[model samples]
Target chain A: MAERVMAEAVFDDLIHPSTRLSIVALLASADWADFAFVRDRLGLSDSALSKQFATLEDAGYVHIERPVTQHRRRVRVRLTDTGRRAFVGHVAALQEVISTAKLGARSD
Target chain B: MNGQVSESEARLALDAVEARRQQVAAEIDVPGWYWWSVAAGWVVLGALATFAPVWASAVGTVGFGALHAAVAPRVISGRRGSSRLSVRRDLVSRRVPFLVLGFLVAMVALTTAIALVLDADAARHPALLASGIVAALVVTGGPLLMSWVRRRAVRRLSA
Candidate 1:
């Protein structure tokens, strides 16, 4: 059944890590966010955020824009289509796991 | 047993996702500067309507509209915040502009109605009085109204 398949959904390790997951979740909610915004919100250092962004960008889950305006550089990030799909799947998988466990508990 | 443990972890992850989404949603608001500018404009327009000649008042209104049009894209997008984060487009309902516009129209109409009533009562500076009232609303009630509108929009869009 579809339920059985859903219950067996695979967890994406790339997105399962807490910091990455948090970043993806935040990005999933918006079209684009600035680098400083993401860093401040996540309470990550610039280098730490950059590292996470590099990981996601390498996976093609996010797109980063660096533009120079008024001689100042700014970075903006957005979840790519691939990233959004992956995030949706991950959430569904999480929900499935929870639901299946609840069902098992009830039956027992 | 493993399944149960995985399920617990999944539940935690799901909770985190929801929390992060909520945090993003909370951050989706027009900057304070935007609100302050709008409030100032409202007061100025009110003053013009009260004291200016008919042609001058008309010009002022048109000028205000033009200024609003110029500034609207930023304000109505509901993307910018006091912080560096811009809200994601998917989370923002397309109906936000319409809601804001409707609110503005209502405010204008209410202010005009108040001015008319005060003028009929021979109140001094009726336009200024009306503007004062509406300016107060803009300063105090603007955020609350935006919050209510945003909640309603999210609920409706989700449904």
Candidate 2:
């Protein structure tokens, strides 16, 4: 399918100190990843990852399914439909910013 | 870090860059005194190959391949680790991908050089010439790539 309009909202979405981008990039590389996996990959402290996850979940960008198996805390992370859209758009927005940043790089 | 950001980001960035630098160094695990000394051996081997073509090719192959294995890591490390500035550390920090790219380029150059050396007229082979040009360009283009990476790190560092 053709991409949706890569608008200004995507840029606005990225203007945050949140670890959300790390979450998106990590999830984008894999279909599903455990919290511990992300924690190690991003090297984020427990509280920082928790705070960012809360923000992202509140925004409907992520779907957290807590499937308990034998007393294990398995918080599996997957991008929601809205999340995939926002992430693709967000990446396109960043690409736009990079290409148009006037370091003489042309639009691809 | 600007003496403001948390200790973790600083460390993660360090891990990201160091992982690849370490790989580049590790890949070229070779003996001492063999890198600069190989050129003399190569000339003698190159002359011998005109008579015993097969033996010559084998010797030349082992000789140059060894030379590369001995020197590749050093060359890559010298370019990447030249800077001491903290800002540069950030640029090199997440450079595992670049190291992979460098490895790929090395493979391509090595194969092409081998083929060129095996040709009847080694000096006239385009593969050899092309590989030389590509290697030179990569060595020269390093600063340009670093400058681009440096620009990104500077932006991230601005916070």
TM-scores of all models?
0.83, 0.36
DockQ, candidate 1, vs. native dimer: 0.44
* Candidate 1 clashes between residue pairs 3 or more apart in a chain or in different chains: A30-B88, A31-B88, A31-B89
Compared with the true structure, what per-residue lDDT tens digits does model 2 show for residues B35-141?
22443343444444444568766877687678667765544432233211011122233463455347446745664666466564655544444444544444445
User: Candidate 1: lDDT of A10?
Assistant: 54
lDDT of 1 at A24: 95
Lowest lDDT 10-mer window, candidate 2 chain A? A1-10
Indicate the residue-level lDDT of B53 in model 1: 86
lDDT of 1 at A12: 75
On DockQ, the candidate that comes out on top is: 1
Give me the runs in candidate 1 sitting further than 4 Å from their true place.
A1-10, B1-5, B150-159
| Residue-level error in angstroms, candidate 2, position B35 | 40
